[model samples]
Target chain A: MSTFRRRRKTPCGLLSGLLGVIAMATVAAQEGPGLGETPSPEMLAAWDIDIGPDGSGLPAGSGTAAVGETLYMTNCFACHGPEGEGLLNDRLAGGHGSLASEAPRKTVGSYWPYATTVFDYVRRAMPYLMPQSLTNDEVYALTAYLLYINGIVARDEVMDAETLPDVEMPNRDSFVIAYPRR
Target chain B: MSTPEFPEEEHEQVAGNGLLHRRLFLSQGAALLSAGSLGLMTARPAAAQALDPWLLTPGLALSGYGERSPFEADVARTVLPVAGTTGSGASRTPLESLEGIITPNGLFFERHHAGIPEIDPERHQLLIHGLVERPLVFSMEALSRYPMESRIQFLECSGNSRPNLASTPPQESCGFLHGTVSCSEWTGIPLSILLDEAGVSSEASWLLAEGADAAAMTRSVPLAKAMDDALIALYQNGERIRPSNGYPMRLFLPGYEGNACIKWLRRIKLTSGPQMTREETSKYTDLQRDGRSLQFTFDMDVKSVITSPSFGLALNGPGLYQISGIAWTGAGRIRRVEVSADGGQTWAEAALSDPVLPKALTRFRMAWRYDGGAATIVSRATDEAGNVQPLRSDFMAANGPQVSYHNNSTQAWAIDSDGAVSNVYV
Candidate 1:
């Protein structure tokens, strides 16, 4: 409990506490004018595609690093380079400990905090020209492949919605929520 | 038929006819001169020339739509080459060419994650789901029906002055260095009103605003801000918002960074916590010297720049020139702007333009008599909240060299003995 208390004093925890205060302040019972109609469930399902850090809203799909390599080589290697080292685009792998150095090459492995975000971003926008055209299984395969290249996971490990969020990233503890004080 | 036998007699007759014709021509010329004098008495050419050109040339009638005069050059936004793809870069406003506070719709700066999406207003709908009781979907028509409000405010990118963070001072024009900020009279409905209409749940702490562009760009805004001064803007500068400025509707947070105000807004999902989206994390987050990053640095600090006599502008002998520029603050209205002629040694308060609005660009002017000796001019803004614009050295001391975003340090322009103006850190 003392260790938990110490953790709560961090910048991230302070921000979370501040958000809680704001939420509590606005919880007063207020009535609405009741404008706009409720959308259909089908419409909600289609647009409610954002996968949070906790693995919520991830589609039912599974793939291994081996399968991901094939998909990545065929589809993603054009702009992302052969090993996701980045060509004319963003470099995706091998930037560990560079954030502290003068030249911070912030790639997936070096800076990204959540593995779920990698899946979400890839699923939402990827392949440069063709976005949202990848299948569910293809997205999982690509996510697994990217993780493997970043050295975050083994080559034979299978990635699904359940297993993806549990895969701890190297920079998980690097992120801190801080709002500049006046 | 006999070819008129007397040739000498015919020649004398022809000369007499010529004299008669000359007399007729002189009489006609005298009549036209009299008429011209009479017309001059009724109408003045000076005033007529000053009137609309359309009146002079009535043949060139109105077209389907009016266009700016051909004399006025179409100022294009300066695209910053940062993104991998062509579509995902930012364009800066042409600040040097602009006059007054409101940025023209076409010349307004644009930052797109996935290029501008051509959205049909009828087909586009704003979905308010997640922690809302109603989970409502508002079409463009429905959103327009809500109570409307308009306010003139400035929106600046967080990375507006990132180039200034370099070890060496940038030599670009003031517009090229600081053109990512623009002011406009935005008209829209209060986001609080919409949240009320949708019946926001008590547990909601954050709102995830997502765009309809190919990138589906998302940002998590604090619910407190949404309930405070946020707006679902539909119009800019008294007209419908331009396609580049976010056509049908956009989330406009008056004092927040430009990215917080998502363009082509499609969905806003309420949540108990921030989603930690890509923009809030990997992109806009500012890195510190210690390697930790600062997130949600939304409000742009007070900043002022000397637009005229800046880089690329030359002063001709420099007698008494009115040094004019803009000052703004995200926290509140600019209380005052101080101009330093000798590079921060002594400061004089500049005259602020009338109708000094809150969170809007306040044009300030100061008269300076330059004797052509080397001189540096700088302006510093102080907001009503008592936040003063810091010098570059002070800002670097506080935020370090690794910090790039939210740089509102006072900028100095050095004028050489030859009357050439250039950027310099004093």
Candidate 2:
């Protein structure tokens, strides 16, 4: 009976002086307002889409270059060119041995340090007009197709989270950290 | 080329090609006015002019917001969009037309990959997760309640001054050649407070900051920098941040390149190592002469550029003119700026403005008396860290000729006998 009465009076008190009570409690507790809420797992699932080079956050999916060709023609060719030669947007393939040349062509196959970056970028932003719209499998296929065209992977090679992290990029060891030595 | 007709006086010639002392104007303003028209004040006689309508009539009523004068409409940032797109491009600040160090919010340069997003402050939230003891989310209102601090700092894109890398000097305006940098007074809550609230894990060495735009831009920053002086900036130039500059909030790392200061910031995840995002690997990396590339280059090099008497701002009849420019360094405060008027054969120390804060633009000025001859002029800056700005040839020799980023070479402008100024490789 006493617990029910205390719970019944709580809503009325909250409606009357909730902000003032919280303000006082916050000043007594910490430096900040301390209004940060613990994010739920559902919220994390919806927004935490970044994938590390070690394939830490890659979702469950599988695809091949053959399946990616159709998706590429439908969505990517308008901006990135038919063969990834770069039409209106950036070039995605070729330029394997041009880094030291007078006119270097910086592309994914030639300069990218990690293969996981391909999946992270295409999943978050691709097709120029519509970003964050591709599914996990479709993003994997596109990554496979790009790697295949660049001669990094075979046409029939499967690209899942397990195999994608092992695909070594040619320029993986070509970088040196330039600042904040630690 | 003709010499000065007036008699010689206390104005000391500091360097070759008629470079005068730094304090010529301040020490001898009244005496110099009696000498001649110093070539700057060319206004028409006021006695011959009638009363303007603005003075004779009532002015417009008060407004909630204000704008620059309509007569100054021509002073605008020059935008160059990417092919077949309107937003994925850069716009340069009119550095030549502006005065002082603080760039007005409207005139700040912009380099956006997926355009600006109109974010509602109430709906925006900042999530701190990953290798943190407490994964938390804070609303804009909650963050606003935290203690805030304000700082005046300069932000520069690493891609600024790309034309200087060319062997032949390109004919372009000073702003067009090197205007990707701007300074502003940013107000924000120190990011350390938020990190403290989140209780960062001991294993975390780096953190990935992501944006809320269509591209969802992301970059991995060292935890040392975050624990240092980084901020979650909410205001620019004493007002709410402009849409193009990250409306609700943005991450601001003092002295770092502009792109690393993610705009429209939404998420931060502590990690054991860098995520190696495409923005860092496929782009923003600097290529070296020996085929190796420099990654995670955050600090902008010490640099300076002369804004006045540059290309398109021709010298009128070559009399006494004030040479002015801006200098900044990511390492620390700018200690000195030297001006050269005779193709860098000699240099004269210019006067730096007061309160030379670190990571902020320092305005330097020098008094110069032109001799109506073809002359090459330039400026170079030295920071408190003992690093001097390099010449184009030396910079290119160090970092390959094909390199396109962090080109902090001195810019040379030539003034012909006809008083027309153009970019020249000296």
Candidate 3:
């Protein structure tokens, strides 16, 4: 790789090589001749729980808005309010036509460009109090309910990994690559 | 009311001839004493006079560590509350009270998503996996054994001057308006060293840097950036990094937005493409006029802020004053900083402090004579790349009023007849 070749020309490479030799010698004198331990696949998987936009890491689960209503009321209502209008926390519904307005209310329906982001955020961090406590099915149901309330999907439409990424959000075409341009 | 404390004979001697003799003798002695004391005072070196009283007296001897003078009050980061819990807010550096280009380790700005996590260095491990030849787990001790590099750089929140975009900007101190950014000398191991040790695969194009905080805040950095100037920072201002500033370690992206720096760095997972994390998509992305949000808007544009004679500072019937501020650019070194006393009609170059490293804050100063009339003072920065700071109006016209991040427009501060300063749009 070019990155590897470039590393040799950098000052960091020269210093690291010198240090690596000394570190290896020190380790050999003590226990063994290695810098770090090899990480187990299980250990990596425990923390490697990131879902990509292309639906790479989504867990298998399916639910409809009808099933999500009860979960939303119990788990999400206190913060997001009934109908997802939002009260204590961020407003998830409405703001569809407010993007061009002077006072833009950037909600789930108004600004978020990707549908997978909603699922990723809700799964990684949600409820404001208890995070990562929702089951895969519960996350799917909540995602469907949020999409339904935002007028992106029908109330009875079932959402799973295959169907969730296909749902075209209103602002899907709103994002443009900013870096490497200016 | 009670007066008979002295002996009758002593009182009489004091009041009578004895008093006259005592006065005469004391007058002669006073002259001699004054001469001797004056000689002693003049004999001492000029440098000795500048020493503090504690330094003059033999205080505590050398110890394991040193501390600032007790007389100096602890300058803390100014915390601004936002929605959510206390940890979900931001704190700014007291830029007005600081000197030199490097911000003190403690006063550096802080922005947390969920909260700061208490991590044990012994238990903490930084995993370098995903598209690597060898998936390695490094302990804090092991990480320290690697070669280290130190650099002076500026880290700024993308929303540093977000309030300036407001229709009515807050009448606050320069530190409050522009303090969300800070410059520091950071010491750390170049990430390329570790990445090379793991032997990064050719297919990896992006690296997801995740923090160990409660939020587990994550941002996808381009592989080129990670290998370029990025550092796994361990020290700030030559001391171990503060707990609030990521303690054990943090990823330092030279000129990128502060959020991408990822405090309390725990993992670096190489991938083929950006993960499009919640932070990059929902929050840090910038909105434009055509309703098209700009994604991966990393570079902070050229910006300058007048620290002195800024908002909240009252100039007392001004004569001649030294106007000072800091100017920086994410692209390169600041080439020039121009100050405007009568809005933008007239401009004067400010003297820039030396050792103006690229991507570091450059301190600039200028001398001004105030006529005591109403005037608007501002500073505009021009970077080495020839990117000049834009006007607020021009910036708004292009980015739209709804845009909230990456605003590097020139700031104007109006001076009233009473010598009071306020943030204003001229």
Candidate 4:
């Protein structure tokens, strides 16, 4: 439903569209879709927070884990620890075997069920004090550092929106969606 | 002098700077006995508390300025925290710190899921529609004419302590535990009276209360609760409601979670069942194992914690420090609060502060003294309904982590030789 894209019958585009119908329409007055009217364009813009099953909210950003290492040192390393094991805050890494115990020590790569949620949450709010101040690229790099510390990715990996969504999380399969069926 | 090494020898001991046993201040056996035998027997009134620099008696002579000025520096903005979990980012009023059956309007705790809305009184309206004999919208003037009565009651957030009772209970001072709850003398038309005015149909099973905030937050209340004790509150603590605590108007659902008592209230649409709003469904509901989720868990149940001599407080010396704390129950008046200084090994009943009204926070005080040794303190509250506050271990063992929100277990803090206080697993 997105006015930005359409089924133009370009044979190759048909194959891509056949996999899934991504109808993100940004319009109203034509009796609209989704069983109701779309929220005002301004409201929609404010609340257009959706992280795809594959990580949709990942903004247009790219980063090298090496650059992320530098950014983490300056921005998040103090509270989150030199390698994200936590300092005054909490351990954001480890937990390779913590989920089933009395305490579930959650971390980025180990407990988070989605890569997209990580990128989306960091960009929207992170570092606690200077939340949303980091550029999208910095969020990507920081997320890369957290993942690398959790052993989910190689420390040298560079990530962009396209590739960031594809990065799988360790506990993604463990999370059974417990809602919407209610 | 022995390196302050407390090996925990199954006595629930913690040794460090300022580490008192979570049970030290909470216990009674020897602590209270020794306090009676040796505590500083000063004849000072409760009003003469040294901790509060601004402890003013209620209805004091005042200038034209109407609102209290405790948090006046931020009055112009009247802003709440950006989101959940706050301190320097955004703080809140301390209700427990005040000594009153009714918390002042400005001091009523703020629980804004969204920021406080800038509502224009002129354009503001209260619409009562759907499943009623006559759907009607009441302007502010019309709402004032209905018979008004004031009653003192307390409201608490369902998720107030979701983060407090971790492996180590936070010694975040009493405001954090008891502060999330506030009591007020609310003046408004009883909701049942309003339903009579609206002529609600008997078939109406639920009432959907929605706020005008940007979130447009909504929740459904049972008709029984709506027609029973809920009030369309206009005044709080004997004054016009503060904007942060749902000024202009709010729904005061007695003995229910504060979230259900919607603020900046706008509409009341009667319905057959719960709307399953985002808050009740996705967020507030406690997800238990076996894919079962607990929803509509309304009542706040019985809970209490000692505020004074709580965490973060350091005693210059341990002789004759009066131990005091607050306790309350959504069910009824708190019957008693047991304090254990020896980590639950021994207990003594504390005296309840006067005017202990049901559904209002009760202040309990007991005199205790320290004998130049480190110890732990713990407090447990028992309500009229036989609901006693659980120990942390008992709570976590039965409830589990997936069960988020409403963890009103007994909170324990340890005091050390250095007069430092800390939260502990015990």
lDDT winner: 2
DockQ of all predictions against the true structure, Cα-based: 0.23, 0.40, 0.37, 0.02
**In order, what lDDT does every prediction score?**
0.79, 0.86, 0.79, 0.64
Runs of candidate 3 with Cα error greater than 4 angstroms are A1-34, B1-75
lDDT of 1 by residue, B1-426 (tens): 011122232221111101111121123432322332221122334545466776677555689966766757655678776446676788888776675688888778888877888999999999999998889998887776665678999999998978788888889877789999999999988888778777789999999998888888889999999998898999999989988788888999988999989999999999988887778877888777778877888888999998876887776663435567899999899999888878888777776867689999988765454666888888899999999999988898887556779999989988898878888886
DockQ of 4: 0.02
Per-residue lDDT tens digits for candidate 4, residues A75-97, read: 87777789788785557788766
Lowest summed-lDDT stretch of 10 residues in model 2 chain A? A1-10
For residues B1-426, what per-residue lDDT tens digits would candidate 3 score against the true structure? 111122232222211111111221123432322322221111344456565887778887787877667655655667876565777779998886676799987789999887777888999899999999998899998877766778999999999988887888788777788889999999988888788778899999999999887777899999999888789999999999888889899999998999999999999999998888889987898877667788998998999988877776676663434567899999989999888888777676776877798999998865454656787888899999999999887887777877898889988988898878899985
Candidate 3 residue pairs in backbone clash? none
Stronger candidate by DockQ (1 vs 2):
2
Winner on TM-score between 1 and 3 is 1
Model 3 DockQ vs. reference: 0.37
Stretch of 10 with least lDDT, candidate 2 chain B: B33-42
| Regions of model 1 farther than 4 Å from truth | A1-33, A180-182, B1-64, B81-84
RMSD of each: 18.4, 6.3, 14.2, 16.6
The TM-score values for the models, in the order shown, are 0.84, 0.92, 0.83, 0.61
Model 4 TM: 0.61
The CAPRI class of candidate 2 is acceptable
